[model samples]
Target chain A: MFTGLSAFPLTPMNETGIDEVAFTRLLKRLTSAKVDSIGVLGSTGSYVYLSREERLRVTQLAVEYSEGIPIVIGISALRTREVRQLAEDAQKAGASGVLLAPVSYQQLTDIEVYSLYEMVSKSLSVPLCVYDNPTTTHFRFSDELHGKIASLQQVRSIKIPGVPNELDTAKERVKQLRTLLPRDVTIGVSGDPYGATGLNAGCDAWYSVLGGLYPDICLGITRAALAGLSESADNQSKRLEPLWQMFQKYGSLRVVATIAGMQGLTDTPNLPLPLQGLDEVARQELKNILSILKNEISLP
Target chain B: MFTGLSAFPLTPMNETGIDEVAFTRLLKRLTSAKVDSIGVLGSTGSYVYLSREERLRVTQLAVEYSEGIPIVIGISALRTREVRQLAEDAQKAGASGVLLAPVSYQQLTDIEVYSLYEMVSKSLSVPLCVYDNPTTTHFRFSDELHGKIASLQQVRSIKIPGVPNELDTAKERVKQLRTLLPRDVTIGVSGDPYGATGLNAGCDAWYSVLGGLYPDICLGITRAALAGLSESADNQSKRLEPLWQMFQKYGSLRVVATIAGMQGLTDTPNLPLPLQGLDEVARQELKNILSILKNEISLP
Candidate 1:
């Protein structure tokens, strides 16, 4: 369930709150694309920006709408108590797994991060994915720390951030991580642009942001990479270089939310407050890029 | 109101929830010490770990127990809506002011941060202090960004993390910052060890963690520095070098919570979980250091 491509969709919101209609539309797209898992409330899903009740509602909505696809809910919170509660809520709502990150205000120690996983893992009946997202969470995991966390009974996957741009170095990095984690503990790649390289580098899954909106293309890369067609996978991903550039330049959340809005899949200003959607220039640029991509590449 | 020694106390918690008795006792200590402001739910107060209801309750408690002393509530949240709500709650609860940090999960852009402060500042009736603690919030403010945020109407103070250790360099940094801020906006320094030097360098306030526990000693340093007795203030702070060392070694939150627990002001495991108190060895070292300090330094 924690393998292949885990499509992370945004929990689109309008002023009234979580846009259930738009959220289900995104989920239906991922389900139809047959992505291996649907990851809701990941950073791309804006989990930390949500209240517990809203997060739980999103969880239920994801499970209900994914059409039998595995649901991995991001259950990261600053408070351990809240993380545990969210983990339980995700399990109760029928999520296949929960993604855990050492989300903190006080920069957490390695021991503190380990303890967080240990405590949450014990309570979770479902599998827990260690969300090693330093860009957002600000907690970096050493290989030794990863080894310790992976040793926890319920921790079944580690979603790493981007790998090195160079394929050889990416492979070497993945190999090093593999030795530290158990064989059953899958290594998933995040940071959307690095998804193809990481998958070709022996990562078992792609925990992707792009996969949320354009699952078919992400899956094209994931399938080719997993089937050992490195060049084919690279070409598929390279075709979307324009989208990748936008993700890097304006942040994946804002860039993707902008695309979703332009596609009419979500309301304008879909992101939560404190996160403004892209400006007119960036939005126009994205619109141009989207039109070009639609002509240049096939998207479901 | 946003000047001098602003003490940040812990909202000491037991397993059940916020220990009101211990919280009020800590509040009383700050009140009796006559610290210039009582800063509740600041990082030292574990605001990020608290729920909105708990935070609102803490805000009211601080206002009630502060006994006419100015109350500065830390109204930081991951979401802007929540931050605005927290600001409104603090103002309605009779807090003298509110402090805000750009608490984010999706590492914020400068515009997003500025927009956050602008929106919240518009909603706030009470004065707002800009909290620039990168160690926790992971948001580094460029001087230009500070100038932009300080331009907002409700912004009355800036809580800088630390100044340089050398008095001259510290003075230069403060002077540079002062140029970017409005004349009425006070500059407060955090990072406890640098408190005396920052004040001597012309910071108007000390947003202090240690002051929350031992306000008299912190006040000793604050008073001497503001009175232009640089050497005297430095020496006063220098006397507590041992405690400062511990704070640097372990985090201030854990070390101070340990002291509070040992002093019977809070329950044994005072910090919210995932943040364990000091281990046995550190606790023993603190015990010996406390005993020695009691005999050497004049502490209240």
Candidate 2:
């Protein structure tokens, strides 16, 4: 079962391409945190924008720095064959598991979606985690469809946003799913800020997008929750609330990247256009929030 | 500079893949219609769903059947590098030009989007057509950005959907752009039904999704418009109204593929997943409309 916090680290890039120095600095910072697992090449990491060679380099960097920590590699593309190739590459890089999202362009049929999971899962010996980010992929899998995916032998986990409509239903679904799936199968919650609620609702694990920047605070909240200290977890969440609010105020996920840059993990919070980085006002607000958090939260 | 009717031919697939027989049939049907040009491996042709080799095969097939006809190949992917490679391949395959969409998944900044186009355009010897399909690509290029792309030497055309909001403004923008761009540079419309209106407004050409199913009808409409016979053109468009209404009912562009399948151009009207084939009722409706059109119109 999924437990503790999984941090999805950003893949640093520059004009020459993959910034190994910046990536190494990020990896070192993340490894120092008490995170349960690390995710590489996910949407937050800008996996889709990378070349095949760049993807491999980033995956290898994550795995190497993981030391003994589990690494879940993101393998998503517009074609199944390319995704399969990515999965193989991730496995070769010694990633503990792979997260696969459906090809975005062609809204695949339910049958094709099932086959996609089946093919990728079969290709790798490692456990497979389904990454469903409907906002980006534009392909939403119904709960019934996810039920079918959960039935696959190699599919050991699911990484989904903790949307309100499906949160409770997903909790029950996962419970029902566990009966038919392997005991090790886990349901992980993404979309931070709602992660604690999802964790309380019976998700196996919760991912922290802001954890790369504020590891101690995120880990504290996760630790409190795991210890069944609801009051302490609630306190930590409230203390971290303002920082997360900065993300919301910025109006996009790129704000999370901006905050990471403010914390010295990345050189610039630059996102590819038509998604601009945090404007000056947003960046100043983010800086103020970071300063307050630094004074308040105990270092990891 | 962009005007007239352009056909996007289906990249026919069989059990072995790349069905040259079906492709030849489609090419023959479209060429005889005297379509101004042919667009290969676009959304309708399932470009993102194809493998690199398959994309090459489709490009080669289109070039061969072009028989001196202009063929514009769609170059779109998550990685700018792959897009550049595809653009190069398209030019090498004897394509008259290339249509490029921005990198999918990540929300691109205007600068990043511009760089992507610049890189792709610079790598290919042939002219590049910047395709803006915001619905699928999730990133919309601003009029300012389009103007910048238009100014690029290799970027010789702009292909935009003929939606209401964009139609008039895009025409005016392109009109001003024509003066800044080369004389041969063109502005094309993707939405076929609105082609005549756009042509009259100032666009150079119209890319047809329906051309594969009813090439003669589309050609007749374009010919009538070119001959300055508005009533004749309207009558031809009226003949297509029934099928177009069916497409409107489905409320998606994928309906074009289903209509193609119904016309016996392909065995399956399938479009990946999430985009199901027309239901029995829709299929029956399409059959009735197509039957009526076949009888009413003198198709070549």
Candidate 3:
């Protein structure tokens, strides 16, 4: 079962194309921090903007850099065929799992939604993680649907955004889901700052976008929690509060890339068209926060 | 430039996979109709749901059936890279043009939107048609962005859905677009039953989802309008009234597929997951409407 911190690494793109050098550095940082798993080509990773070749390359690089650590590949696509192909690619690249978001454009019926998961799961050999980020997908997976998807032979986990208002509801649903799903299957929380409470509420894993830049702090917190050192975990969480505040201030995508930039994982904090990087003032603020966090944690 | 009817054929799927026989038959029907052009793998064609291979097969079949007739391939994908690759495939398949919608999931910035069009247009050798179906893409192309895309070297046309409140605004925008775009560059209005006025308002083409099922009626209306026979055009418009109402009642995606089913195009109205087919009652009603139109037009 997945537990502790899963870092969604930022995709680096320079004028020449995907910045593999920057990506290598980012991967080394995450692996060194000993994150439970590293997720690639997700929203924070700017998967939507990258071409199929780029996505495949990023997945391969993540697997390579993660060493023995599990690498979860995001296989979100507009069409099932493409998603299936990407899933196949991910498995071939040695990713431990694939994360899928349902087609976002149209509202799918319950049966349609179930079939999408079933088809994708059947097509793949690797364990599937159904990503339930309704904010981007626009279609929320109901508890009943979640239960049904969990029953699929290949689906071993679900990653849900930890929005506050829906936190309790998701918790209740996951609690019931635990009964329906196999004992080994995991239920993970995304949207980290808000997810801390959900993790405490018994979610099997906590996914952190901010962890891409501050893996040490994220790992520190996870290690503290794992060792049952509540006071130390609280201190790490408090120390990372300013960075989380920046995430809240900047949009999620921008903040994610900006954090990656502060960690020197990427140069420009560039996002694909429709999404832009943070302005100079915000960039500097993010840098300052990273500096403070590094000093406090004595992160190399 | 694209003044007549265009049939967006429904993709055929069977037990073995894409039903090439049914696909060929459907394409032959539209080609025999002598449609001004054929839009392959469009919304009416179930573009979003098909696998990359299925999409390519449908495009190739349409091109083969039409011989020299223009074929416009729909290129709507969540990832920009897939869109580029699809554009290349469309070009290789001998498609005359490619229609691209903005990146489906993310709310793109104006600059990102511009860059998407620029990149796709640059990648393909054929003329590109900018498709702005905000209903599905969830991202509206502003007049400024549309104008900028129109100005791109390879962009030859645009397809805008004619929603009621936005009709006049679309007309005014198209008027400005005409000035910015090349004289030969066409502006096509989708949502055809409701878009006749936009055609009259000077759009170069009327793209129809209903045309897939009712090519005879669509062609008749187009011919009448081109001949300046307003009364005849009005009569043909009246013939489409019932079917248009059914489209509104059944939901756009299902109704488009149902039209293909009614025309003996495909079995099972295969919508990829998330979109369901019409109920039996709606299907029967659609069949009845098509029967009436066929008899009225003396079409086989």
Candidate 4:
């Protein structure tokens, strides 16, 4: 059920509060593109920065406008009770699934990691997707631990990170992960620009950032890979080459925000403090790339 | 005014809420111990995990109970507006200074770092102390950026991290930082077990964890180093060697929470989720060390 290009919307905000009008437009664009699901309040959504009230408001609105689209709300929090609370809130607000990452100020042992998932999943009636984002969380889950989490009753999917430790090895790891876990567990991949290799490896879906911007491009890449059309998928990835280089260089944040600026979507770009978009040199580089790939990168 | 051995109390919490009575007792003990200052809501204090109301409540209690000890409240947050609001609250509540760490999920640039400190410091009447905890913040302040932030009008002190890249070179780095930075900025060292080395190298203060548990031992080491009594300082450090080894092995988190557990301070150790205390084997070792160092490490 947790498959295909799931759009992770960037929460639009201004000085006063969440830019509700801008958010509505973003949601409308996502549903209009016919993405498989909406992953509201993911890291790309700036869930960490928003207050509880504001976070819930985003979740409620995503559900209201998604119009039958499955919503996976990001419920990563610093405490177990808070995580559980966010899970219950997500369920009550009609979200289809809750995504959780073991976010900690200190490193967590495997036992603590298992108990966190167990405790939260018990409160939740909907499915939970274990988000293995070691880059941001600094907590890595071994395959042994992944199996342990997947064995939990409420867990229905695992979001394999799109970051490749070694470019060649990442696809093999995804293939290995596909065969290792329970067949019941859907294996979705995030870091969507890099989604082609994972999808070709028989992963379930692309939990995407580009799916939020222009679902057609992300969907094109994934659908091609799913149908055993590697050449077609490679061509799509080639077109996104410039943006992928930026993600590799300085995270995907500035590139996405800069693209939003080029579009008329946001005035002040709803990024968290101290995380500005591309500097002048990088901005110019981006412009040069976009001028060549303009039709491929632009929204309707 | 931010000099000498400063104590950062662990915020004791239970299922109900913040253990206010225990927190007050913790404050009174610090005041009685005559440590330099009180830093509330630090990493040990679990500031990132806490709600705004709970954080403010702890701040109020720290100020009220602390006889004349200067209070430095940690105001690290994901958003600038939240940081500004906290700084204003700290000033209104009579805190001596506010501590800001440019904590973000998004990696920040030098311009963003300077602007974060600038935005918050401008709203405050009190002095601001910049906390450099890269392990938790994942944001390193290059010496160049440090110089820029220190030049801000309201930033008077910098909590220089004492975590060594190499044990032998840690003190040398402190010396280099002291030389490169402005003479007026008070360089306070954290990672307190290593305080003797940093203090001996001319750091002005010790931002301490053990001081919250046993101030005399930490203060003794810092004062000896300050007085140029190397042998006396070395003895104090050698007495606390077992605890330091544990901090090096794991983080100082489990050991500190374990000591608080042994003291019967609270039913729960008050650590944030997935950051539990030491395992059984480690606890036995900690007790053995305490038994040997009882005279030196004991509180009044």
Candidate 5:
């Protein structure tokens, strides 16, 4: 289930509540693109910012709209009990797998984090993915800890932060981790700019932000890399460097929200308050970049 | 409202949920001790671990049982919308002020954080305290940002993480911050081990976890420091070094929960899951330390 491109869409929302119409449109777009899997309520979806009812509703919508694609629901929460409840809810909502990040308010000890994963894994009937997103969760997992968690029952995949930019080093890093994790536990890479590098370095999946929005282009890169066409994959990724630059500078969430809003895929105030869309200057730059990219390569 | 010894109690709970009897008793203890203010739902209270309904109920109870002593409610949340709602609910429940940490999942920008305070401040009728708790929130505040936030109309105090261990350095750090803040705004210090040093160094309030559980002894140190009796304040704080050692070794939250459970102030399973009480060895060490302290100083 965690083998290929997993497209994670934005859960557009405003003051009234979740933009159901906009969100449904996004789900249909991913299903139409035939991406490997659809990830709902991931970091890009702002799962932590939502209420339990809202998260469940989104999960149900994604499963219903994704047209048979496997659904992975992010179930990160501050409390272990809540995380367990969310995991159970997601599985009940037809989730193919669940992603759990050690979302913490207190500085969590290694033992506490281990216990969190251990306890939640027990309640899950479906596969579980260890989401190691230190940038957002602020909980870094040691290699030994990652190994310990991956060996747990129901643990089938590990979503690593990002691989090194250098192709050889990225391969070596992934190789080192491969030996630590169980043979069946797939290693998927996040941080979109290095998608080709990670895939070419032998990562099993690309858990990508760009894939969530522009599934066709991301699928093109993923299919090429997986088929041993590393040059084609790298070329396709290089062609989107301007977008990656904006993502690096303004953050992928804001950049993606900007695209989603400008493209009319979501409402004007797509992101929740305190997490606004890109400012005027950044928006203008993104628009200019998109125009240039459209001339260079195909864009939806 | 934001001065002197502000006791921050644990919102003890178990599988059945918040122990109202235990919580009410803790609130009464703070009121009886005549602490200058009561800080409910601060990090020690596990505010982020709870739901909005639970947090609101806790706030209402704290205001009710504090017997007219000022109450500062922790209004931190991942989303700004929730924080605003919590703040409004807290004020409606008769809280004197609110404390907001830029609680985040996505790493927040300086502008995003500043805008959060600005927006929430507009809706607040009561004063707000800038909770710069980097250890928990993982959002560090620059002096420039602190000056900007402290100047906001509703901002009445800045709860700094801690002062330096050395007395001279602690005084200089506080003095430097004093210059940055408004004349009317006060400065409170958290990180319980530094309570006496912070007070002696001119922090207007000691936001001590120890103060919440053992108010009489903490009050003695706070009062002595405020009266310029540095030696007495130091002596009082030093007498409890064994307790502080446990706090530094095992987090203050865990240490406090252990004590609360041992003294029968709260239920046995006081802390939320994933945040267990001290391990057996640590608990035994704590028990020995408490016994030593009881003989060394007057313990309740």
Candidate 6:
């Protein structure tokens, strides 16, 4: 069911609780930009850092104001039962689907990984998007495991990270996934820089990072690529190259949190102590990049 | 200062909440068996899975019932600020020291890694033990970084993981740490099989795993090694060779959870869903191991 650009934003927070006003405004911005769907409490959303109650509160706010932009709740946990419980909670909260990345501190076996998706997906009526994020979970899904997991009853989609491997191109990886997976299973690629290329190469969706702050820009690129406008998509991607470089260098978490603060969305943008956003030099660089991109890209 | 054997157990849980009765009983069992110290809310304790409130409750129970034994609280988080807050919370809760691993999903630079410890240690009044569990954190520490962290003002100890790496033995790593670090700082090693060897090589402590369920065995090995009784220490370690092999094959988290369940400490062991504790066959193998060890090593 998941297709096109899914915008994932940083969870704006203040000292007291979530900055509801800023968050609502951000949601409104996404709806205005007409992104395909919105992924809440994702890695970009800092789900791990928030407490259970706080995370639920976030889920509540997201569901309440997503308008028609489908809200796919990220139900990630170290435990399988917790992931299922979270999935149930998301369904009750009116989530369109659930996203899960089986996170573990221990080295999990292939069977362990398969069993996890099997249990959670079977229990959910809504679509479950298997998040293949090796950076966060350290659990890589082989093509064989992907095939086994896709057979699970409610696994409707697969969200893979942007593969920057020198040998295999993202396009080729998408092609392999398309061939390996069932036809109904939606294939989406995340990681801002690699997204445009993946979408152009036949991925069904782009689970976007830049879409969080700049939904219009991401939507522009994603739409262009999807409509077979490769040149336009490449140009749009080139326009955001500076931000992509920052994401590659410092990660989307750091860069996104910095951008949220720079945009004056939330005061306590950086959560989980001691991790301050972009340093002074990087802040200036981000500022210049944002200004140039703003000038280059206009409303659709 | 923490020395000798420190028992670390899994935090028992049921549908209602934390299984406090079972937890208390496990604590009592360790205390009666005479562990030198008790590390509660540690990795083996499932620290990351528990909520902030739950973690504090567990910490409170640990400190209150510890009687005379010191409690070292695990304060690992992705953010430096949360780690600092947890350290402050632990101090307030009457903990002896805090153990931190600087866990991050994103890869951290040497500067970022050292900065995390530097900032947190500066903010903490109590001793901070540097936990080097690269397997869990996915962040390996260089000897140079370890030397710098050991020089932190409040850092009183180093806790290295049981490295089976051919390039770096735990003993050699301990020797290097002891030389590079200040003379007063204590060096401890975890990963049960390596404890006796690390202790014999000059580590002042052994932050153990098996000690949680069977403190007497670990205590015997640690004490013998501390007292320069290599023959006795080797004998004690050799006694645990089977369990050590299981730990290597599957990981301590799986093996320990099974041991706790097999010992009837908790019926529902913490296996982190999708991954159940050692299956029935493995459980039977474990029961055989425990029954044999119980026969071989009598209670003090």
Candidate 2 Cα deviation (angstroms), residue B62: 3.3
lDDT of 5 by residue, A1-300 (tens): 998899999999996689999999988888999999988999999899899999999999998897889999999998988998898899899999999999877778899999999998988899998999988888899999999999999999999998999999999999999999999999999999989999999999999898888999999999999999999999999999999999889889999988999998998879887888888998999999999999998874
TM-score of chain A of each: 0.98, 0.90, 0.89, 0.94, 0.99, 0.94
Instruction: Please report how far candidate 6 places residue B160 from its true position, in Å.
Output: 1.2
For residues B39-131, write the lDDT of model 3, one tens digit per residue.
887876767766678788888877778867798999877656567778888888888888888755655657667877888888878888888
Docking outcome class, model 2:
acceptable
Q: Interface RMSDs of all predictions?
A: 1.2, 4.4, 3.4, 1.8, 1.2, 2.9
Kept native contacts, as fractions per model, are 0.83, 0.38, 0.53, 0.68, 0.75, 0.58
lDDT digits (tens) for residues B57-131 of candidate 2: 888988888777788898887766568678878878888888888746755668778877776666777778888
lDDT tens readout by residue for model 5, B50-135: 88899999998998888889999999998888988898899999999999999877778899999999999999999999999887
lDDT scores of the candidates, listed in order: 0.91, 0.72, 0.74, 0.80, 0.91, 0.80
Best-to-worst order by DockQ is: 1, 5, 4, 6, 3, 2
Candidates ranked by TM-score, best first? 1, 5, 4, 6, 2, 3
**Model 1 lDDT per residue over A95-192, tens place:** 99999899877778898899999988989888889999888888889999999999999889999998999999999999999998888899999998
Over the full model, what C-alpha lDDT does candidate 1 score relative to the true structure?
A: 0.91
Candidate 2 per-residue lDDT, tens place, A74-131, comes to 8988766678789889989898988888857755567667878877777789888888
Model 3: how far is A265 from its true place, Å?
Answer: 2.5
Give the runs in model 4 whose Cα sits over 4 Å from its true position. A163-168, A295-300, B163-171, B295-300
- What's the lDDT of the predicted structure labeled candidate 4? 0.80
Query: What TM-score results for chain B in every one of the models?
Result: 0.98, 0.88, 0.89, 0.93, 0.98, 0.93
Which candidate comes out best when scored by TM-score? 1
What is the C-alpha lDDT profile of model 3 across A1-300, one tens digit per residue? Answer: 367788888787853468889888888988887889888888788786676788899988888778788998998886665677788889888889888987566666677778778888888888888888876787778877888898898888888777343546755755876776777678887877755555655677778887876687677767775566655665667776887688667656787776666555578745554456777888888778768877876654
Two-chain DockQ for model 3: 0.35
